[model samples]
Target: MASSADDVFTAICGGTFVYPAVMHEQYQDIRVTNRDGVTLGSIREITYGHAISRMVSRATEEITRIDHTSRTIESRFKPNALSTFNEFIGSDLLRDPSEVVGQNL
Candidate 1:
């Protein structure tokens, strides 16, 4: 599952063709050090948002945009997701870029 702030990349109704390689060398430090848990992306999206008008209404907890050519990514996290994130990661370290501050989570 390739997940981003706004999208969870899945094909054929979310079935995976291959493992995500959680044990890859480059990701070793992340998995090895943060044994307890992990949260991805910048949380600056936690408090900001934009409204889009549509004929069919829907609800969302987050929003994200990526510009490959410009090499930029943006995300917005709503109250529920933010609160949940803070609860999971703790409220004390609710900074812009959410990160692993300690070893073994």
Candidate 2:
């Protein structure tokens, strides 16, 4: 069995969210936190031109889902922008379980 921490990581591996502010364009971001709300680190689709392209390409594939297609912000808004690039990707990542097996004993 996987520990709670493991579960959390697996859940956020390739998750999706709707950003209404960004024209409702689907996006993905990695946010790691503990029970105390201490964030470990986070990586959003936003990528930089100076950044590694190989890493960005691989990450792009991992974050977006194949089912519900979403426009990658990088491809749409700033395709030629001399800045970081953002990809669209999402999956079942870091979501609360549908049901709890048990309660406080």
Candidate 3:
């Protein structure tokens, strides 16, 4: 449903590369052009593979934080009585699906 954030920003500003979510209902924006002529094999290399994993994580996190119902990300606008202070919490994928793949590799 969501597009990967790989081509988002520069390296200094941490980038994310989201993976495909076949079950999602929304359609990703079409980007058919090959800007740098990079092939699928090149993108599947270790560096890019890692990037994709990280992007998928960011997309999930952003969704949770942006979704008003989720309340996963702490917000400063929240009533000052909920807790001592709002905290920024990043996603932690425990026992990830890719964990097995990494171990085997």
* Most lDDT-accurate candidate: 2
| Segments of candidate 3 deviating more than 4 angstroms | 1-14, 21-33, 37-105
Clash pairs detected, candidate 1? 45-77
**Candidate 1 vs candidate 3: which has greater lDDT?**
1
Q: Estimate each model's TM-score.
A: 0.21, 0.17, 0.15
Show the lowest summed lDDT stretch of 10 residues, model 1.
23-32
- Report the C-alpha lDDT of model 1 over 1-105, residue by residue, as the tens digit: 112222322311232222121111111111111211122332221121212211111112222454446644443423333222221232233333223222123
For model 1 the local lDDT of residue 65 reads 52
lDDT of 2 by residue, 1-82 (tens): 1123223333442443332222111112322222211122222332211122311111211222223245222111222233
- In the predicted model 3, the residue pairs found to clash are 16-55, 17-55, 18-56
Per TM-score, the best of the predicted structures is: 1
Q: What TM-score would candidate 3 get against the native?
A: 0.15
RMSD over all Cα atoms, model 2: 16.7
Model 3, CA-based lDDT: 0.23
TM-score of 2: 0.17
lDDT of 2 at 61: 14
* Superior by TM-score: candidate 2 or candidate 3: 2
Q: Residue 59 of model 2: what lDDT?
A: 22
Please estimate how well model 2 matches the true structure, expressed as its whole-model Cα lDDT: 0.25
